[model samples]
Target: MPRNRATASPLFVPRKATRTQQRVARAEFAKARTKARAAQAPSRRREHEGADPELQPSYPASGRPGPASARGGRLRLPKHRMTTAVAGGAYPFLAEAGLGAEGIFIGRDLHAEGSFCYDPFALYNSGRIEGFTNPNAILCGVIGMGKSALAKSIATRAIAHGYKIYVPSDPKGEWTGLAEALGGQTIALGPGLPGKLNPLDAPGRPTGVSEEDWTNEVRKRRLLLLASLAATVLKRDLLPMEHTGLDVALDLVVADAEATETVPLLGDIAHVLGNPERLDAALGDQAGGLGRAADDLAHAFRRLVHGDLSGMFDAPSTVAFDPAAPMLSIDLSRLGSSGDDTALVLAMTCASAWMEAALADPAGGRRWVIYDEAWRIMRHVGLLERMQQQFKLSRGLGIANLVILHRLSDLLSAGDAGSRGRVLAEGLLADCSTRIIYRQEPDQVQVSMSLLGLTGVEAQAIGALTRGRGLWKVAGLSFIVQHLLHPREKPLYDTDFRMTA
Candidate 1:
């Protein structure tokens, strides 16, 4: 039946193969496929001949080319060699980010490897500091340690930023040349000099102030100036009676000036204090013993008009104060060498009052009221009180008062222990949130540390700071900076000209 079916349908049928036969067929198929792949390998290699060497497949080599040898077994990284200090500094986690770059370019922050900048007004307005409401500063360093140079750099640099400087009292006249160079005015005052300043002179009034307010301000300034002058000369505070006498004399002098339409001078106040009838007529029954009580004050003022301190401040100011000037420096060098510290103090007081009048103008822009040789002025009660007032009103007045001193000891020497002078002197430092300390002597380390609240590292660093380097503390942050000076500023700010010469 099968043979008949194959012949009839012409069909074919297949049977299952044995295991040995199946294996032989599979091996033959694998051999054919392998031959096909081998034939394509040469062509694929030729196509990839121009490919990047790095992109090519990598294979394990006999030895890796590194510091370790094949005999060493594993690859090893080269060991780094450095001192502990160097290694510590190399770690990014141990470094400071530094004060964000804003403000006047002061110098370089040695630690942060960045520019150090500072501007009190700018910092305050920007809220870079917390709870610091005043734009005041203290720059303390030993003489010849570049404190003055740094101050000069700040002032000179700030001028370009539209800031005006008022050096109320330059004891050494160091700022006179700088003022002139900056296209500012410098008023020189001394014995036998033509320069005269009247502290009682009326200040430029702010716009929108009432006449009554203006009159009251002038009266107040005059009274304070007279009292301060008397106190400075007397080296003791005026008694209540003396104050009353001064008030009476000032009132009479002001009244006469109002009627005469002429400014009153120190002599007029002295003249009125010496004449009891004149004061009695002006003050009526309220002038009891005022004239006699004012005798000491009058005599004290007489020294300004007729004594060694005469020819300056007894009459009207010969040099006009141009507040619009870039800078104003009152040169007291002539009196500075007179061996009479009182003369220098008096001159500074008068100059300050005269400039204050111009500063009273609300239109008067921001200014830097530098108190160079601050130690010399702080010893005087009158000047110290004036500085305290200035510090309190710094924000409202749009001014920054820079108090420069030779050492912290200068502050300690301000007055006897627990005296008002001492309290006020310390108060000055307290008001100034920005403290710059240059190289200090070893003995000053304790005082500087306690006063400034510096860390042991900072305290020790302060003693070892080299020239032009300073420790800057602002708000709660601190930096050790190296001040960079412009070549042109060197001659202008050099305090060692005499030594060099």
Candidate 2:
């Protein structure tokens, strides 16, 4: 009976089911598939999560993806092809990290695309630049190349920052207008001018200095001034007798002033030189040929006081040297017509002596002593020696000397090759760790390169620089700068008026 029922059921089974029966079958099939997926989910997760800790794939300490694994791996990146020139902009290795922005704003750095600035005092104090302990600088350029403009801009801009400027001698009178514009004073010294400076006058003593120390300093300065003047006029260093004679005469003049509490004049020293009796009394038997030896020295003093160089520094200063003033310029343009090298040297000597008095003050703060037309000043051996002395003591005196010249060859011309004068001149250049070179003649490039130790690139740049553009070498770093000028500063610093006119 069971076999017969099964056979009938199989044959009678409908090929198609009714709508309600089809819905129930579909629902049951979906429920069975969902149960199967749910059961497989944990197994798949465990396959990923159940790895042994020690055997798990390791990544580099940098956290970057490791080598490929069976499970997964990092996506591969395509190689990039680019020229070095295009890549250099993104990673600049040849660029110069310029001198940090500090001190005075001079101009823009052509290489670094930013402003350029220079302050020797700030640099020295900050110690940011190595091997540049000295605060001196040399600026060299041909005429109309903006050397003077740069000098004036530095001086004028420095005035606003409380640094005093002392232009010992302005032979061309170029600083007269600038001095007046800065609310500073310029003492015009020439044949007809009423200005007079006494080289022997005691300098203003620094505070905390004893009277004895002050007196000794005054005597020392006066002795050096007189000796330097004599040597410059004679075109030779002073002999032992001349030195002794000068010492005796300076001592007497200073002694007389100390006794009378008055300032001595250059004529006073000349008078003592002419009269040996006073020196003999002071030296007692040690004054051998002192008077006779001083004849040339006396005559040199006479030339300064009552002779050709008279009326400028012959007597006591008619104008007071107010050290409180922001700037002081001695205009020697009047003596330019004289064409007397000795006279200019004497004027510079006296002006330097006068400034030394103010510079003695420890509280004078930082100051700049600019030697414009430095080529002319370096020619005189005595003046060159004095400049060397000042440069050596610049840090102690809290002063910086800026020498402006036409070329480095000007220094070589100071004396014969290998001569002491030449050596001293070269030493001056060596001491100046900062050198600003403007456009130069093609012929001068060799000398510039040799003297400044410029690289081939820098040496070649010297001749191609335009007006107001300069190659600034600070310490050991190099930068090409375009000096900027304000509209108001144009009229003040313009040296091309003649051409413009």
Candidate 3:
């Protein structure tokens, strides 16, 4: 009975859409699907562009979760996929955990700041980075950044560890305290002057005191100084005196200088001898500029040996050469000159002294030379390649070299930027296996940081690092760390300081 009453109540009840209307709705729905597909298919519209997830905008806090947030803020990442990649732990932690941070460990201390910490291994342990395996260490930075202090620190530590150290002192009186502070002996040797010997001086009988001996020492110093200057001017390494006709030419100049007693520029004879081929070429030929330069070098030496070149050797300079020393620091402050000349003289003297030392010891354990402000000597010494060659053969001779420079452009000045010469330089760096890169400017920082293939976070940390702080890349791992500054080395905060500048 209720159904019968309701049968006529719904005249206006809606009917199903007509076929045409339904078809229109379907068409609209299909159009919308196509639009959605176009919006979603990003790769279809763009060519040549990479899909970088990092470039994607972060979702609103209300919209999505980040990896960190999704992971509940667990900062420790999982083990690196490769066996060689470092795992999470302190420097010493790796070794203790049996994972081994043997190469170079860039890790954090409790304070959260970064630091470089190496393991202590036996002296004969070739795997250990200690003991100057390369026989070279460069400590370079602008004035006041503790360059000297660092030298003192390394020198002191090396000495305490029973390594001999030779210091070429400056007038700043930095090394006078070194002998006492480090327990090594220091003997000052200038062209001819002998001052107080610090306790750090290597022990040996007076080699000799004959007039001939003194004359030879003085002549060696003069020749070294002259050769350094000539090499700088020629922009190439000079042939050693033994193999060329240059010895006679040098003798002539020496005799002339001794008679007139005046050091003359080798360039003065350029007209007499047009630029000859390099040393190798000169050796192949009987006549050329090489011969003329040799003659001029001898003349200059003669003048220097007598009293003609008086003030040239009078910079209040002194160098300490000893195979027993673990380190050698050439102090230029006492030379009374801070210009290129002073740097060249000191570099030449040090190079000659080092050569002599190496020759004296056919089997020294391992010798290292650290040229701090490399550009200073290199600006006029033209010894960059020579220095690098020494580094190449150094491991064979138990010698290692650490060359420090403020900029890459310094190497460019020596030769063509494209000249694979840098490849050799890079090879030397590659062999280093351990590298510490400090804070750098935009240009250098970009290139330097790029080398390690750093991630967004690591690159950011490196870019924001402050003075005495840097990224350490050793073997393959890289991390930012704060380095310990030496007390004796000046604060590297000067206007032109290497790190902050």
Tell me, by lDDT, which candidate is best. 2
Worst-scoring 10-residue span by lDDT in model 3? 196-205
Q: What is the C-alpha local distance difference test score of candidate 3? A: 0.44
lDDT of 1 by residue, 1-501 (tens): 453232233222224545555555556656766788689768767766998988865532434433354575576799989764474457532234455566678898887677888888888888846756678999998888888888888899999989999988988889988988999988888877788787777877788999999989878887888888899898888999888878878877777888999888888888887887776676677635455777788789899888888778878778777877999888888874556588888887888888877787756888899988888977787888888887887888899999999887788787897998899989988899888999889999999998888888889899999999999888676788999998999889877878873
Point out where model 2 deviates above 4 Å. 1-94, 287-291
Local distance difference test, per candidate? 0.81, 0.83, 0.44
Query: Residue 157 in candidate 1 has what lDDT?
Result: 91
Clashing pairs in 1: none
Q: After TM-score superposition, what is the CA distance of residue 61 in candidate 2 from its true location, in Å?
A: 54
Report the error of model 2 at residue 279, Å. Answer: 3.0
Alpha carbon deviation, residue 171, candidate 2 (Å) = 0.9
Estimate, for each residue in 1-501, the C-alpha lDDT of model 2 and write its tens digit: 343332234223233556665555556656766788689768655655866868654543334432344336566689998664565455442345566777889999887778888899988998877788789999999998899899999998998888999899898899989989888899988888888887766766777989998878777887888888888778777889889988888778877877998878788888998887777778887645465777888888888878888777767788887878888898988875555577888888888888777677768888999999889887887788889988988998888999999998999988899998899999999999899999999999999998888999899889899999999998887889999999999998776788873
Give the per-residue lDDT digits (tens) of candidate 3, residues 137-162. 43333344344444444445544445
- Per lDDT, what order, best first? 2, 1, 3
> How do all models score by TM-score?
0.80, 0.80, 0.52
